[model samples]
Target: GAGAETALLLGLPIATLALIVKNIYNGMFIPLLCHKADAYAEVGDTRGIERMHLISGIGLSLTLGIIVTVSYLAGVNMVKGFLDAIPEFIKHGLSVATGIIPALGFAMLARLLINKKVAPYFFLGFVLMAYLKIPVTGIAILGAIVAVVMVNMPKFAASQPAPAQGASHDDEDDF
Candidate 1:
């Protein structure tokens, strides 16, 4: 019971740290790289897109490698003082961080998600989870199905030729 309580208490801060790491990397850092790729597209430099992809791949691999190495070190107590220092101050440090991390996470998300185009989708997913009780796996599969359908849907309206100057001013006048 004590161990379970301790585990539950510790989980919040660890999960908060994980969320911060995931959001910063995915929402902020990755987009910066994607923006760089878009800059290349601006100049018609297709190679820059490929280069960004390569850089991102390398970066992701390096990050994972470092994480694995550090985790292994921590697990076996090979990191010595660093390993010992964590719990020495976890109550002081992580308790504060537990509150701060979500604030920071929401700040980051406000920038990323509170936009006109994206907010609706965000609320839709939130509703699906909060009210409808759709599982995340089901939502993801449903999203993918919708995405596939949307992508493959015809663009006849966009592809259609504009009416000749004399053909019809009727539709334009209504607008």
Candidate 2:
């Protein structure tokens, strides 16, 4: 609950900033970087590439770290005061946007996650958490096991189907 509350509270402006950064990275910086790389390649400058890579990685990491640190410091008191200074209608609009953004994120995830391959795991996790009263630790362990099995050993799936709806006689005491 604390994490959720913190996420909801902090997600609004952070999400906005992230979108801005992503757009800039995709639209501008990426092209510039690519062009620079191509130039280095054209000139047969092998060392340039290594330098560019180092610069790119360090640049982005430092930028993000600074932003995070500064944003966190500002959010400690200044951002709250700044928010308080906004008009009532603007504040109301911000509240609406904050609520809608998470829903939008969920919608996007639902589109990606509710597919055939993933649905069974989702349902299994849901049932484990909701119906079977499994602890978070148990469900996490099971999810990890399932993930490993799915990735490394497709034979497990072909050989034995996890019982329907993840409900089975053997798993009754797993909680």
Candidate maximizing lDDT: 2
lDDT of 1 by residue, 1-175 (tens): 5587655554444444444445456667788999999999999999999999888878766765665555444542343333345565754665687679799998898887698875776788789989999999888887788767776666655677897677564767777
Candidate 2 Cα errors over 4 Å, as ranges: 1-81, 154-175
- TM-score computed on alpha carbons, candidate 1: 0.39
| Displacement of the residue 103 alpha carbon in candidate 2, Å | 2.3
Error of 1 at 127 (Å): 1.0
Q: Which tens-of-lDDT digit does each residue in 42-142 have in candidate 2?
A: 99998987777777777676766665667666773554555456578955765687689899998899897798888888888889999999998999998
Each prediction's whole-model lDDT (CA): 0.68, 0.72
For residue 95, model 2's alpha carbon misses the true position, in angstroms, by 1.8
lDDT of 2: 0.72
